[model samples]
Target: MARGSLVPETAAHAATTVARATGHRAQVDVTSDGAALAALGRTPLLLRVTAFSMFVFPSSMVIKDIGAAGTVPMILSCLLFVFWLASWIWRLHDPVRVRHPGRMAGVFFVLGIIVSYTALYGGWTGDATVTGLAAADRWLILAFASLGLILVAAESVKTMADAMQLLRWLLAGAFFCGVVGLIQFTLRVNPMEWVQLAMPGFTYNGGDTPFQARGNLVRVAGSTFHSIEFGVVSAMLLPLSIWRALYDQRGQRWFHWLQTALLVFAVAATVSRSGTLASVVAIAVLLPFLPRIARQRTIAALPFVIIALFVAVPGFVGTITDALGADTSDPSIATRVNNYPRVARMIDAKPWFGVGPGNYTVQNAQEILDNQYLNTIVSMGIVGLICVFIYLVLPGVAALHSARHAAFPALRCLAGASAAGLAVAAVCSVTFDSLSFPTFALSYPLLVGLSGAIWIMVKNEGSSPAPATTTPQTTRMD
Candidate 1:
């Protein structure tokens, strides 16, 4: 039978047939086992559970209690760490198959953070609600968990298909976030209020308030703790939705297109210039490599989409106008700008070791320094800055490496998306600490893992078995 004719039920039978035809019945059971494992690997449940947990678990409703310690993402991160450890012990997958090429860089980054934090031990002078040691411990826990995620992908994910599958699920979660954000924007409905009502005794951090605004328009916070969190989540989703709309032309193509629009509208409604800018950057980088027809159609429709958005949504245009406006009179913008000098001085004082992981907010209690780079420098010092470069910038580094090495053509798209996503995130970080929010924070390591996984597949493809006919790449796109 032809390869395409083989269904799941026949897959084992087909394997047996092939073995029998080759007079290798003695090896038939082995062949069947391999085929079964292959089929199991292609199952979507693992990706779905992992992605959904990562995306949705950060909500207050998902937490068992009010404190950061009780948050679902934190618990999930620990579980992910345990999973990685188990995988390591059981030799569940090739130990070195999906190595984080930036492992050395990661070590340096972590060391830098430790040294910085240790250097500032007992030196904290700020009035933080939490002690410096406690803050440092929280930061360390997150850092280690982020590292585990990278390692998990490295050890378990064996192909480009697996990496992209996780990405698809993440995009699905992002779509849900976008939909909720749209409702919040349209009706001014607070999902947090609903969560609070349903889950009694659930308290919100002062920072996790239900409403935020820019000028005269109320921003959409979605199910996340804050509007900026929702904006950043939407920003990250925007590119993936566009990539899906442009590429995946199989089933329900219009649905993908609608997903793309919802993500765009979600970003706009948040009235966040950084988030909107990040989406634009991702799309800009993504456009060049796309099939020509998709590129042109998407670009051509932009003007009409913008016009329709303004006409249909109340305060849409004005919200965007006020957001991007050069009005230093805008309190948020002014505060962010005015505080730069103080951050610069802080960084200068601790050029090597930073003022510890959680010192900045306490030290500069009244000021909100929106810049992530500055935040890193002051918080973790130059070493922390280097770590940021390794994780965030190295994906693009791997992408460029693959491009030069003539990796798989499909990998080019994944690399481009990864590079663009990270770039957009870096830009967003400059306006708001993108890595500080739970959703955005978790997203970074997840994407990093995906990037590393893709590079590993491309790097090892020459020796690996040819992709199955049921591979996602084969089914989802050309």
Candidate 2:
């Protein structure tokens, strides 16, 4: 009797010890404290560099020495690079990690360089003058290089959360800008001028202006590349809103609905076919993913709500239908289709590195060609296309992986929607590259969103491997 009691008691003690050890291991945060700071510092710096480079260019145009204007981004980039290096060195002892599709993305990004370098060589024409270089095309070249670098670096560091926060900032900014545009329409004012507030020296000067400005609606592009580019930005936000809607509860996160609605209105005010089309496409793709409960609830309320809103605002239904119209008379549409085949033929001649970045505008004599894929090939070459491919593909891979591991439905929706949105946007890009315009900053956030999704996916997935051994380690000082 005594021996039996002792055995059970001893077994219980041993079990308790093992359980404690297991809990300790599970709770451990393998990440050294310095790792996170280094990552964070590196991540936001990318945003700063991009904004500085592009924004400075426009304001810099004000300065006579173009080189001085150009040097701003260069200096910012160098400074950011220095900071990143020092931070990495501080956290050098921490383990570096990345999972599957991210690896594939990194590989693809490098491959795209072939296309970039091809463009660099093929389009040079032994005339290396910046003045001789394609004016708008110069931005294209910078875009390619920047995107390639951003892709590889983002993947290498794996900063998904940082990306998400940036995207939120982007979408919120876009939404507010959309509101300003709506306000402009209400006040019967120039929307572009209002957008210039955030970007002190920014101004929009082009559009299909006629004798009456009404025929030539100058959509407020905010800090984006162009009004048309703003359309793409608006399109990108719709999916983000949907993702939020799917992930968040109405009571806890009503802002998702509000933001989404405002975004839709923004899209309406822009009157951009591409932007509207992108929004419709993004929402349409997201529709099937709605939960049965949400879908049912929406079905019950949506009809009445939509009808009420339409009745309250007579122009609402008309605006929607008008937007949906596939009236082929649009010259911009016709112009794009007509130019495409010619650009394709040009690609046939210089497929490896199509022409040179921004050369299409110059070669075509300062025209808004408005085709991203064609422009890419024409500017950088096959190599440029490859690099562009890398920039887009890696984030997608990260998003897909994130979707697989997302603990929250909203996060999953965000990840999936961003991925799908990018996919759709890429399709749009083949025909249109809005990132080139001075008013188009929406693409920046979209890119960041995709990159952010990847970072979240990686971080969550990484944590799964270690469990939650959350120890306080000194984060490397970035």
> Whole-model Cα lDDT per candidate?
0.60, 0.47
After superposition, the stretches of candidate 2 with alpha carbons farther than 4 Å from their true spots are 1-82, 89-96, 99-129, 132-168, 191-223, 242-256, 288-292, 295-329, 362-367, 404-408, 438-478
Please write out the lDDT profile of model 1 over residues 108-159, one tens digit for every residue.
5467667766676655423334566667776776776677566554444544
Structure candidate 1, residue pairs in collision: none
Question: What number of backbone clashes does candidate 1 have, counting pairs of residues 3 or more apart or in separate chains?
Answer: 0
**Please, what is the TM-score per model?**
0.80, 0.66
The lDDT leader among the candidates is 1
C-alpha lDDT of candidate 1 relative to the true structure: 0.60
Clashes of 2: 42
